[model samples]
Target: MRAKAVRMYGTRDLRLEEFELPEIRDDEILAKIYSDSICMSTYKLVEQGKKHKRAPQNMDTHPVIVGHEFAGVIVKVGKKWQDQFQPGMRFAQQPALNYKGSLASPGYSYEWYGGDTTYCIFPHETMELGALMPFDGDSFYKASLGEPMSCCIGGYHAMYHTNKQNYDHEMGTKRGGNILIAGGCGPMGLGSVSYGLVCDYHPRRIVVTDVDDAKIERAKEVVSPEYAAEHGVELIYANTAKMDDPRQGLMDLTQGHGYDDVFVMVPIPSVCQLAGSVLAFDGCLNFFSGPTDKNFSASMNMYDLHYTSTHLMGTTGGNNDDLIEANQLAASGRLDPSVMITHVGGIDSIAETTLNLPKIKGGKKLAYTQFDMPMTAIEDFAKLGKSDPFFAKLDQCCRDHKGLWNPEAERMLFEHKGVKVEV
Candidate 1:
């Protein structure tokens, strides 16, 4: 079948093109992608193309599709998995298919298996490794957001605190413990806050620090302090960018006791240092950022590491179980990952939106593969609605739901007059 896809040709080079897909093998599955969440990792991959661990070297010759956090319906089922996954069933993708410990993942490694496309094939390896999850969520956006949510869940699960007496490591964040998310208020950080609020491991206090006050305000508005109180969690959004001593100010939030779990959300040396310096005894630090640089390093308090039993670890993506939990939480309405979406676009916007992702403000830039709309911020919907009836309806849907992108808005997007997109 022929499909339109955003293909990465080289570093900083992406193009939207229509191409024919080879017939699926007996063990592979074919799917039609609907919604794909633009990720920072895709930005890094595009910036470092061949040098990226997951990017193939010969991109000029064999361009790979450029997305991962995506969801849609199954179009064709392979012979082997007919009983498990049927055509017309909804599904979400876990891109980190660590098959045989290879760095190759979907969105970064595949030619026709990524999410930024109208149609793609799921390799037999995907089925064998269980990276393709079948979900019946309310909207495709929720399933797309699940992939990023699972990343946060993995970081949460990887958090470990050591026993002072036995020196044993306990997995998962400490219940009723102080948690800090450094460089938070971004997309993944918002996911962290959402998961922390809903997860069984209740944090006594969750402090989020970001450089941008606007982003902090937006985070507070979406995941409000009032909502946190309802969940028996103290949520605080702090602007540490202007602070002379960020570590001290962050520690002061915990009453100088420091935090039990510190999550580094951004790939900056200063944030890493800040996250490390404010850890309490037996504190677990999970570096959640994936930097493009090979030798990225940051100074840390070694005394705390050696004597204070401070644990440090990093997770790139989540496992199948983590994805399952994210889907379950989202499906049950305990977690609303839509707060991460700030912009909406179509297949035409993938290349430009992805290339300038860092410069673009706000959270996840979601794209519908079959649409032909420009990248427009959700916040701009009301302003755009003044002239266009389409934006007016979408804006109303968002306003009805506390200015959030919901399933109703997603349905309205497709039903909008004269906005039909075709490849």
Candidate 2:
């Protein structure tokens, strides 16, 4: 069998090519991918080329598929997996495979499997041990959101400093009493917003700060005003590029005490420093975005941390259990992950679409296994210079409904138009 895939030949060099599919081993299951979302790190790896240790090491590389977040249906299963996963069963998989003696799974490493292809072969360990989640929902796109949502779960876990006996026992809230999400316009940031709303701690207020005006506007447009009003969540749109003291604005927002939980979704060193500056007593700052270079460092007051009891931790990827919980969250209808999807295209556009990740805004970029839409087509829809019919309708919907959409209505629209309403 032949399948379409995006092969990373080297840094900044990716090609859409056809590759022979490996025969399903007795312990392997074959999946037909329906939707895969472009990750920020995928863009980073493509641009960084050989500098990315996670990329294949040589030209003889196996033309590894380059995606981690996706949802698919079981197309074929080996004898061993036949009893478990049947053909046509919809599912989402955590692409991390841990063949190493260590328990940790192979996430973006050379030994791991990726989802940015038309089909994939996954091992029994991944399929049976909760790495692959069965989709009970109507849309594959919503299931595709599991990977990022799991990462958000990991970030929240990292942000909680359980060692603080007093706060953990008395206040019952994790490390930071209140949570602050910086650079909240991105998909990861939005994931944080969704998770924050449902977290056990239930911070007094969830503050989302962003630099992009358009994204800020969109955030306000997508996040339900009723949810915000009920949860006491506030969206702060600030110009970080021109601000002399971004920390000052954060401090002011927090009533000068600072936030108990802060997730720095942006990799900028300044954003890290700003997170550190706005931490409340015994607060924990989780660097949600992995720094691109080892040289990247942020400054903070050691005295403040020692006296105020603050912690700084960072995490990457997520465990299989996290993905299961993420899928459950989305399927519950409490959170609409589809609203986060902004672009959709096929493997042919992966190269150029990934190259422009830094410039793309608003929501997640989805790569479809069946569509042939080009990068330009999506850009044209987004760049109608504010006159785009979609944007106009979206704005009207937001205005009339106060930034929330009826998922059922949206589903009807997509289904009526045969637009593949996943999520």
Best by lDDT: 1
Off by over 4 Å in 1: 242-244, 417-423
TM-scores, one per candidate: 0.97, 0.84
Q: How does candidate 1 score on lDDT?
A: 0.90
In angstroms, the error of model 1 at 248 is 2.9
RMSD of 2: 4.4
Instruction: Please provide, for model 1 over 384-412, each residue's C-alpha lDDT reduced to its tens digit, 9 standing for 90 to 100.
Output: 99999889989989999988899998888
What would the per-residue lDDT of candidate 2 be over residues 1-423, giving only the tens digit for each residue? 678777666667677777778688898878777778888878877777666756546633644567778787888889987777788888987765554543323224432245677777776677666677688876677787888888888777655554555556232236235678888777788777877777666666777887777777667666744676676555444556556777787777778888888888888877788888889887888887887777888888899789888888787877777777788888887666765666666667776778788886556787766556554323244354287575455445434543443334344334434555222
Model 2 misplaced stretches (Cα beyond 4 Å): 59-61, 101-113, 162-176, 232-245, 376-423
Per-structure clash totals for the candidates = 0, 3
